[model samples]
Target: MRYRTQAVAYPYWVVALLLYGLQMVFGLLAIVKYLGPDPIRAVLPFDVSKAIHTNLLIVWVLTGFMGAAYWLVPEESRTELYSPRLAYWQLGLFTAAGVTAVVGYLFRWTAGNKLLEQPYPVKLAIVVVMLMFLYNVGMTIWRARRLTTTEGVLVAGLAGAAVLYLPALLEFDNYTVSIFYRWWTVHLWVEGVWEMIQGGLLAYLLIRLSGADREVMEKWLYVIVGLTFISGILGTAHHYFWIGVPAYWLPIGGIFSALEPLAFLAMAVYAYAATRRSGLAHPNRMAVHWTIGSVIYSAFGAGILGLAHTWPSVNRWTHGTMITAMHGHMAFFGAYVMIVLAVVTYAAPILFGRPHEEHETAIGLWAFWLQIAGMFGMTMAFATAGISQTYLERIIGLGYLETQQKIQVHFLMLLATGILFAAGVALYIYDFFFLVPRGHREPTPWPAAEPVEA
Candidate 1:
């Protein structure tokens, strides 16, 4: 923690981690609902459970992203946060909004949009929170006048996410129009601006953890951003394919979506090249592991798996199936979730005032590998179930319920793997809150490394 104001990020991380644990709980409940005899169907139905599960995921990951930015921006700008009080207020209000939205969902108070299910008031609250956040961050950069490309890209991504969310606030009378614009928020987010966020965080991690050249890493950031816009922005057409859009979108979406992998591939190459070129190891090996793991997993999950289904021909069958879940689980984890964890793990020692060498705790390693194994198993389960569903229902002409019944075995696999994933999440939460020191025991200034030119 170079600046005293950086301490503000601690509470943000705490909230994010707690919400992450809660998300896993809801996810497990969702899987059980899929596999079961309906013991609590009247009280906690599958739709509500699934909605809570997905909403919690988005909330926690965004919380993590904000926390990471709060941590990163000050360091990059070489100044204290412009307003710690404002940051805390933003966290509190944002959290309240999220919690209120979740509670409301239990009672079925929602707008019924898939990801944008939050009611109008909650959406307004979220917009207000984002405004507060951007104002504080933007002011900090202006005061310091030292915005690095890394933080610049990060802030831009965050701003774009806020702007893009405005479309979700609008309601359309036409279902096709509603669905079309909904993708403007959903697809553009995870695939577009969120990729920029991932790239920014990835560049920061690679440079710091590997002692990689700032110039080289920043250059890679440009390439990643360029690739993301070139592929991701246009890739929005892919979701429009079956949404009663014009037929021209079919070829346009396929071509651009296919090119989407180039961004993730560039990130993978960026991390690898940074590590190899620097050849200087940071003591925080677990952070390095996560940093590297993010790019590799995303390449396969977000890039490869996404491409596998985004084609008009394939997605015509796979959309809204378990296959989407398959890609979503791994892609979100790899691209957004892992990068956030990378920053958390990297900052843990400084935040807790522990020696940097202490970062590779036994519990941390277990948490990392368990999550990897669990998510891998979950993806496999979803893939098999989706394939079977597509064939049994889409091709073999079975009813949806009949198809699901046939795929019960895969649901069993999902439950088992989901439990493992939940366990990993539990370990991570425990390590963060219990094992880590509540406050600094001793003065521990992390030694700054000289940048190694690549």
Candidate 2:
């Protein structure tokens, strides 16, 4: 590690990896519950397992994000962390809250707000942790007397995410009203500010990994951000289609949400363009694979799949069906999960003091393909199940349980794919933790690379 303080990220990333592995466990469990007799139905219900699965994903992704910032900011700012001490405290608070939330779910203690299930105290703690993290991050940049657009965009996104969460802190009794504001928090984060974070990090990784001109890359970053804001903000209306909202939102949502894919397309183009310009001179080309993989997969998942069901007519049929799950699985995995893993792969050498030559290995390649194939199969499984369910239940007017019974075959397929995906996830953790690290040395001071001229 360059900075002694960079070691702080070790615990952060470690916790993230562990939680990520546990996430797959719950995910597989939920899928199994769908496929067969519920041996543990009385104790561990599907809803609880699903909730834990989803919540763990959020916590771990955010943890990975925070950890990435800790590792990247110092090198970017040309200074050590403002307060490693604060980073430690923030991770502790974040981890504790995650653990408590998981434990509480087992006991059925929740706010029951559908995905915003973290209890009030835990929510408050999350806010505090964000505050600490942002303060440390902000102060670090401030102290360095330097800030790149890449870093600026990243910090802004993180700040925006923290602000958006405020709405989740409040409660509403009316279902319509609650759902309205709930989108403000969830949809806005996923479709809005979080894209900026992804764009920023994507820019950072591509520039460093591809040997591309920083100016051209950041210029594309600006375009991506502009497109994101243009589309994603109004894309929020897509959720308003059947939510007792005004008729105007139907057209507005369809128009803007469809455009949201444009930004994702631009991101994929941005990564590919940068890499082609440089001819992949970077030794850790596998990291480049991940970086570029995130871009294209996100376009396919979030952009293409999202467009598939985003229109009002299409959503009317597919909204609450397996189609939603299909799109969600690909979108989240493609956009958020892959980007985080991209950074983890790219930064492994720097973070762990390994030689750059050891960046990507054969095992890493295996893990990557297994995951990509597994997730694709899972998406197809969901797509088939959803289509059958929609046709049986909605179109043919069959009862929900009866339709589900008819679709049990798809559930079995889902379990099979889930197991495959889970294995890939396991192999990833194993390769990242066990095989990636073999020795350690005194912390070496890594000097910032010379600036790439405009």
**Tens-place lDDT digits, model 1, residues 229-258:** 999888999888877889999999999999
Model 2 CA deviation exceeding 4 Å by range: 444-454
Per-candidate TM equals 0.98, 0.97
TM-score, candidate 1, is 0.98
- Every model: Cα RMSD to truth: 1.5, 1.8
Q: How many residue pairs clash in each candidate?
A: 0, 0
1-454 per-residue lDDT for model 2 (tens digits)? 5466767777888899899999998999998888768899999999999999999999998998888888778877878999998999899999999999999999999988877999999999999999999999999999999988888888888889999999999877888888999999899898888898899899998888877888888878999999998999999999999989899999999999999999999998888788788767777666877788888889999999999999998888887999999989999999998898888888777766666667677778877887888888889999999999889998899999998899898888888878777887888788788876765555445524412332
**Model 2: worst 10 consecutive residues (lDDT sum):** 445-454
lDDT of each: 0.89, 0.87
Return the top candidate by TM-score: 1
Displacement of residue 443 (Cα, Å) in model 2 is 4.0
